[model samples]
Target chain A: MSFEPRIVGFLCNWCSYTGADLAGTARMKYAPNVMTVRVMCSGRVDPAFVLDSFRAGADGVLVCGCHFGDCHYVEGNHKCMRRIAITKRILKGMGIQPERLRLEWVSASEGARFQEVVDSFTEEIRALGPMRLKEWAFIPEQVEAAAAAHGE
Target chain B: MDKVKVTIDGQQIEVDDGSYVLEAAKSLGIEIPTLCYYPYMAPYAACRICCVEAHGVGGWSKIVTACNYPVWDGLEIYTDTPRVINARRTNLEMLMANCAPVPVLHRLAQQLGITEPRWKTDTNYTCILCGLCVRICDEVVGAHALAFINRGAKRDVSTPFQLDSESCILCGACAKNCPTGYIKMEEIENRYIVHKEMNLSPNAAITLPFRQAVPNVPQIVRENCIHYKTGGCMVCAKVCPKDCIDYGDRPKFEEVEVGAVVVATGFDSFDPSPMKQYGYGKYPNVISSEEFEVMNNAAGPTGGKIVMENGEEPRAIAILHCIGSRDHDYHKYCSRVCCMYSLKFSHLVKEKTSAEVYQLYIDMRAFGKGYEEFYERILDEGVNVIRGKGAEVVPSGYRQHEEGHLIVRCEDTLIGKYREIPVDMVILSTALEARQDAKEFGRKLNISTGADGWFIEAHPKLAPVSTTTEGIFLAGACQGAKDIPDSVAQGGAAAAQAMKLMAQGEVMMDAAYAVIDEAFCSGCKMCNDMCPYTAITFDDAKKVSVVNSALCKGCGTCVAACPAGAIMARNFTDEQIYAQIEGMLS
Candidate 1:
């Protein structure tokens, strides 16, 4: 069977979540690769929740928030922006392609933009293939064999 | 202005007493060439080439310049007399001796049958020193910035002391009137003079709105008018046939009683300066599609030439679509007219100039009839259509010296690679959004506006032209973003709806309204702020919010905001909503 990417999208309640509902109501077709989790606000998301989704075999994680200053709770999306920046670095240190994690902003009225961001991010993750931990784990013997293959 | 009789070449003619003999000769179809005479200015008979023999009533005759000689009663003028012809020939020979063989002089020399001047020819002198430009500058323009310097052998026209004078308004009157084409207006200061106060001014004070207009008459732009500025120059008033030109007339409000109102207030183009990355207001060549449209108009400043601000044709042009349309930060709705107009602009540029055209756009929505075919035709016309939103415009040229260019950055989504194109001009297809005073206008008309500031109609599909207000109707871009065809269709529908209401003498209101159950009511008053139409008001005596039934259309906002479940909309309750949900599930 061909490997289809399973992307977990964390959408906030005020902006990005309503943006997803707008995309559905507008009938704009996008890739059906993402499973959305509706949080109260983007600031309510924990960094540990991101690692848990990756551990649960999700190929990619999408964190969406309100645009800057458009948060329903005033500064909730600003907190999410800072948390996602740190989480991206943590994913990079764990030997996963940092391209698998994306932080986006979609206002309630931008249904077309939400669809575009979803389609493009899905295409990007598809090019990176599956996230297999066995293949990504760095062992000394495999590294030496890869180094010897280059005649180093 | 009094009339007088004068005889020219044995034909008697009546002319204005103060008018010159040249005008009388012109009226009589007698041609007498004069180099120093301009029609709009006072005549300086420096050339003496229009010499004619004037016979007094007492049979005495003498030679005189026909240009400035005033005509009187019983005055006989002979234009072909031998003495008059000899005087004109001698004057032309003396003027040609000092001036080089220019086209104006050569054309006159051919007519007079003069192969060469009798005196030595001086190739060093190109100017004929006729003082036509000097008289036009002093008498007509009222600016004495240019004057003749030195004397006799070294005479020349120049600015005061041959330096840039502060008195020079750069009006180019002297340069335009220079007969020998020796005068040119050079850039002695910051060349790009930005006139901030002018609004879409093609620089002419009086102009037609377009080539084909309803009234098809010229209107004066009072802002840039020289008569209004100096309190002089009543040239238009002097020439008006009906004498209907009134400079004192100003814009005023008019009151009219109407049975119905069609609110067809249109949209305004989104100003791209706030976007910042495209550098619209910062760069010289980065102009919005609205400005580009004006530049492409036949009667525009450059006469429809698609040229840069420097008056040079652009080598390449980049058209960026959806500038503020369909974007999260600016406007979420597409300005439906921009795509077709941008394509038309590309077609015009290709037809007019040999410039390379590039269009960067996201999702070309040519959904209208024959629009897709036009898009296909544009594709066949060699326009490079890149399916991506233009991200930035960076000035990347040393343009002051020569062909400077701007770099347009985009993703090029079809190729899945980031690309930057360098072009001489960038035309931003800006969006058409709601007018700034739309909300206030909606309030004055007792209509409701949506989040995007467009007046909300009764229903998008059924009652597209009807608003919640009974006698008021919506039309064109006032209701939503629409193209010309859709706006015309909706405007016609709105006009018919209004006429129907006017003819019927009444309008039917929506029967559904919200009511508050006083038994379960609390003094919360939160619904007063939540109601979009201001239909709910707090009663100070009862401490409970009351619903104005006459104003309510049962939008159900108070029903959802009521914490105690006090408000119940007519024909729409929680049970009814749940039943509708169940039906949808089925």
Candidate 2:
């Protein structure tokens, strides 16, 4: 409980980002557990971004934008979803919680939504604690010697 | 709360005492032809096609307008009869004698078996003087520029003292309200109907009405004329690559002859701006759902990137659902398109950058096929889905370490505590609203809409695309708020409806049109002057006014106003109606 959980977020330029502005204008406060990145569309968020965020020590990540059919890039959000599905399976195989990665859709006018997702996700990550998968150390010398013996 | 027993068409029925006959009939799935009876607006009873014979109080039967006439205990009503037919026919005949020569009226006249001359024609007649135009202009438009001038036979519609009244703001109230072509609408060939769609900017307003309007050419509203604002600004015309905008000229009417008409009028977006707490128009970054689409579009102002108006990419984003929808404060209907769209935006923002994404919604409605899987995928993609409606959008005005961004505040219901998260952006999934000009368009087509601005479908489930008008159909967002798949499906459905009519090679119209009573027609020609459709024609050889069956809409204005009771609507004879009244009375 004393340790801080790190969360990464990808917000669409149009709806979700403006929603964050609305939150600021309203003076609403939520957990400072999230780091954010802006993208033209949620659909444009490549799977690599989530994997990279995890590699960069993020315990959790969030993606948000306008509602479906309401996407700024038209069908960009749809593509983001398809790509996310593939990445979810890959993360599960990698011994990650998979729950640490999350996707949320927010619009520019939804400031309250911004607060809700951030506050909730932060708590969720806290419950799960820091991602220990990246923290695990492997004995590189032993693995190298074992690999050489097996090959020779 | 006791039910009132009433008899309609020889059947006893129970209805609420205060309910009108039309409402009662609707409850029983009865279709009644009516105009000037919009549910939102006050009933005028100007078009009396729904007139019925009712009795039971002292056995006294009388004809009454069904829309305004309330139901009573032991009341007997007759909707159809030989007598009713005569009255309906005679009324239609009178209306035809006065109507303008529009095709709809002529067709109605043909159905009623009226074609020959029966009354004298008036030469100096164009306006129908139906009083609908005047009332709607005053009541609906909230502008009193137009009024019926003069008195008796010399009565005419004018703006004040017959000159170009300065009070006439040219909002087109009189023209739009006109039942007849009396206040001729200024219809330029390429001019767009400005208020027909959701316009985010003044530029959008100017270019709203163009057909096939993707990147439509903009023109200055003549009344809100930028030239009038500053005395000389031709920026729109100058910037136009096609030289499509003509600033120096006023809108003019151009008549075109066509075998068919396709009404492709689109829909509008819900205005969340009125909910000032959201800070829609007040905030620079807080944009409408559609504006955000434009901002995120490659062809839009931002060239396909998620950024604030200041051109900086956001670090965090939040999406809110159900603006102007499923709320008692606004439309109490679930806008069938918001949920999936929220998911879509979530995926999009996450894919585009490393920013955190959050979806705030009252409910996660992924009922559509393959939608639930998509939702799960988005959740797995590291986007946070919060199950709660947003309470408010406020600015913490926090900057120092966050590069100046907004803080979103809300109670995460699942966790049972308030949360404030600083994010660079927020998005509101605003609901789709009805077109502002829906009423005007309905008037032109002699159709109606629901209490909300969406056009009323003939039947919600069975006839989703058809309208009250027999040949007309609705498609896309015009009928209601729907996703792309549904919109496209409706578009095809409407096309199929039109194709069905065209494939039949003939349109079967209402056979209850007007017929002239040659014996009673005093050759007064008053009816000839009042017809809006111009269905009546005077024969010099016959010395009597004639109606064209193929053009009459059966408005029945001339029938009631007729001094001689000469013309009548088919299936509505005076004698038959009198008999029905007598029968109801006893």
Candidate 3:
């Protein structure tokens, strides 16, 4: 059977979410590995969400928001960028491949982008193979403590 | 603890895993030409300047944006290759022809060894539509003023259809960052016959709050606007210099779907008015740190003259520390700036007017480079350093009715004595407060604010300049109270963050965007027009509108605007949001 990765995508309500809708309306063919979570701003995607997805069996986590300076809420995407940077580092500290997590800035106009990103990130995650429960073994208590420290 | 090995420019380098190409390149001292990349902002790939060639199995060799590209194990990347170089050069040439000035283009042309324009146009504007300035101004500055006005061949950078934009804060950012010289800011003042002082309150025209500001131009405060007030008063237009105050303009609601988001909203200063004990409103002499910055500035009120209300140079100046900060009554956060700025004020006052300077503080925090030494030098100059918290600033009652000379009451905690020191001037170091309308603004953008009112960053320590909003950046005194060094550093950092994103010619977005349940969709086309990033389209053939994921920014305006409730935002579908809401209720 072909490997179907479970990808969790975080879409900002303003642009990315609508772009997906456009893709669907246009019947754009793409991968079905993605399960999207809508956020008001890409900035709202807590690192907890990304890590939580991994904890909940998501093979890849994708975060989408407005183009830079294109946020409906002003600088929310900027905040998301900074957060994702630190999150990637934290994810690396764990046994998780940072490449499994992606942060991108796309506008509502690029439905093809929506299709492409999902296809690409899904492929990347698939290439990385599955997150090993033992390889990523962490004392849940320890991860919780770290998450608390990072204020995730 | 282990470093991952990646090859760039045929050189093997060991960098920590999860490192981006730009970060890895920087570690190896590889200088990549970038325009719209900032570390604080996520990789946007808008400019297509940082394109590099990568060769490997399953490695698509077409140019990929290096800024956003993640470094992988056993990945062979070429930072400089003929195909990649040509693409970059062509992209830059198109940009140059569109926006760069003769000198910058000429120099670049000389370096690239191109003598003439391949696609020559006879236009005077020299700004390449790199979108760096637009992204920086909107995302970093949080002003949403300058943008790419018009599209394609008619695409010119202007404020809402080439009108005098009251929206622009005149931050001079567009001028400061234009790679090409097409967008030169010429300050032209329009004269108006004066008459409305008595009818106006102090806050009436506060929209132009930055008028008489240091970088003197009109900075229209959007929240305090009459349009925002009662949605009335287009007064800014009636009395604008260069007639550059357009109220008829609104932000373009386009959307773009992406795979990831980078939150880089910066910080803002704390306002100290909650402690009415400082008498900020009642005492004309007491001013916040920013106001004092403007006051002491050569271009500030009183024209940089260190004079009291009586129009006399202060014989003795009292500098109060931590008006709204470090006190339990106000913000518990130490405004890392008060001490150094207080000393700076003391020096400026002493140098300009030779006044006796007294610095009253809870504790002298000179933690920066040359700061302790600066404290010692100020002491050597005989500036009185009192270790105590100031109690209050009252009137001396010696001068004219409103011009009563000021007196500072303080408790010298060390000496255990209360000293009502007589002084000609009292400088209140006010706290940097969050914007009053932060919550509403956050709601509009689908982001949240911290309890302290400042836009909360994703990670306080690791991500200092980012907020909870994606594709946006915070800079200057908007995220939190910071010193000059930190603000400037953050500003440049925010710019770099944006550069990284825009540097990618095109961004890949997540598929978690809205998927219209076509049967439910009413074909209203509201989402198509309401999108701020222009990410939606109507398929006449399909008889239903479609959203372009690359263009959709995911603002739920269309979802809310949908009368049929057909347009549902993804990831936050009506079902999921309702489930969460229902769970909360339970």
Query: Which one wins on lDDT?
Result: 1
Off by over 4 Å in 2: A1-152, B1-254, B309-312, B397-403, B537-545, B583-585
TM-score of chain B of each: 0.69, 0.55, 0.46
Q: Candidate 2 - CAPRI tier?
A: incorrect
lDDT of 3 by residue, B1-586 (tens): 5677889998999887776888888888988777667654557776777888877767556677888888777777787778877887787677666653467657656655566667777777666666776775665555666878777788767777777676665545456555655565655355221222322333334433354546554444554453443343354565565788766656689899753343334445555556666666677766666676766778666888877666777788888998878878778888787898889888888788988888999999999989999989889888998999888878777646434667788999889899977777778876666677775666665554545666655455777766545556666666677678877888887777667777875655665566667887767786676666666788898878787776665655566556677776777665675454333222
In Å, residue B64's CA in model 3 sits off its true spot by: 84
Query: lDDT per model, in order?
Result: 0.80, 0.69, 0.71
**Local accuracy of candidate 1 as per-residue lDDT tens digits, B226-287:** 45644544567867989967898887999999878899999988999999999999999999
Q: What is every candidate's C-alpha DockQ against the true complex, given to 2 decimals?
A: 0.02, 0.01, 0.04
Q: In terms of TM-score, which candidate is stronger, 1 or 3?
A: 1
Over A71-106, each residue of candidate 2 has an lDDT whose tens digit, in order, gives 533445666777677788888987778888888877
| Sort by lDDT, top down from the best | 1, 3, 2
Best by TM-score: 1
Model 1 has an lDDT value of 0.80
Query: What are the TM-scores, per candidate, against the unseen true structure?
Result: 0.58, 0.45, 0.40
Error of 2 at B372 (Å): 2.6
Candidate 1 vs candidate 2: the TM-score winner is 1
Cα lDDT of model 2 by residue, B384-445, tens digit? 87767776777755556754666666778898878776777788899877789986776566
Model 3 segments more than 4 A misplaced: A1-152, B1-276, B280-295, B299-303, B396-405, B511-586
**Best prediction by DockQ:** 3
